[model samples]
Target: MSTFGVIARREIRLALRNRGVVITALIFAVWFPVISALGIAAGAGGDAAAVAGAIATIILPVGVFMGYLFCADAFLREKRDGTIETLLCAPVSLRRLWEGKVAGVAVPAYLTTLLSAAVTIAAVSTLSGTPVAAEPLLFLHLAAVVPVWIAAAAGLIGAAQLALGMRENQILGFVFIFGLIFLIAGLQGVVSGISPVTEAVLAAVGLALLALARFIAGKVTKERIVRTIP
Candidate 1:
């Protein structure tokens, strides 16, 4: 395997072994979608528009939040345990290592979001006694755009964790968690307003942000990382 793959697999193994974090993230991913589906069934009888809207408003944020949850294990916990120092000494570029860690966290988070989406549709269909289907654009959003958004979010958080001190990471974690809460609250108003054009625009922006995160992560030097180590 390539160094990147090796690093990513290692992180994946570690993430799975962290049953507490994994279970908590999975529960969050599953619970929200089912609750949202219940609301959609009651309000809109699980119509396609309602289904699409719920998927749009809920899936992206949930996926990103999963990234946030996993990133603590991928970056911050490793740093705290002093394992990151060993990785830093390995024959891998900083950027590659960062990318690997992001991928490790993002893959599982994205899969969990997929599970959320599936449970959401199933719940809506069951509650409404009618088959609910997502719009094609919304399907694309879930399959393609959502993963990119998750990766972008993970990359940014992981990079920040690598570059900042523990106190700063704690603050960032609080800000990130609360920001997602506020984002979810704010999106409730737009559940029925999401359009394909909006999804496409968000996808484009996610790509840009991911690239920007890569650039920022690449700038984190060994000296800086070592200095930040407690």
Candidate 2:
């Protein structure tokens, strides 16, 4: 396996082992999507497009939240356990380590987001008592754009956690929660009438953010991450 794949698999295993983290993420991924799906579908009252857009909004924040949460395990837990320092002493470049961590968090988190979307789709369809599907643009947003967005968001969070002190990481956890709330509230409003234009705009933004994150991840060094640990 490639270094990135190995690290990602390792982090996925570690993250799944955390009962609290797994439980929390599972609940958010499963329940909130179901609830939101029901609410939006019922509100949209048989409008498949609106319901789909609304479902996308519900999962978007959840994806970001889950990414940050999993990243805590990948980035901060490694630092706290001293594994990061040991790895820093190894022959691997810091950039590869960072890349692996980002993928580690992003992939699983995106999977959870996919689950959220799936659950939402099923629930909304069931509630509507008919086959409901997203518009092409909205579907693209959920399947393609959201995953990239989640990766970018996770990369940024993991990099920040690696570079910050424990105290700041604790603060960052709170920031993530509040940021999630903010995004959910704001997104709920704007996603109702999602158009191809909206999808294109968001996709562009996501790709741009992902590029910036990759650049920043390459710039981060072992010295920077290790120095931040308490």
TM-score of 2: 0.88
lDDT of 2 at 154: 79
lDDT of 2 by residue, 174-204 (tens): 6855664585466446644667766666667
Instruction: List TM-score per model, in order.
Output: 0.90, 0.88
Off by over 4 Å in 2: 180-192
Candidate 1 residues lying further than 4 Å off, grouped into runs, are 177-194
lDDT tens digits, residues 1-230, model 1?
89889888988888889899889988887788777877777876546766567667777888888888888768877678898789888889999999998998888888888888888878877887655563676787787778887888888888888889888988887686566446545545543456776677667767887898899999999998988888
lDDT for 14 in candidate 2 is 79
Candidate 1, position 225, lDDT: 90
Q: Quick one: best lDDT, which candidate?
A: 1
Clashes of 1: 0
For each candidate, how many residue pairs have backbone atoms clashing (under 3 Å)? 0, 0
Residue-level lDDT for 228 in candidate 1: 87
Give the range where candidate 2 is weakest over 10 consecutive residues by summed lDDT.
183-192
lDDT of each: 0.79, 0.74
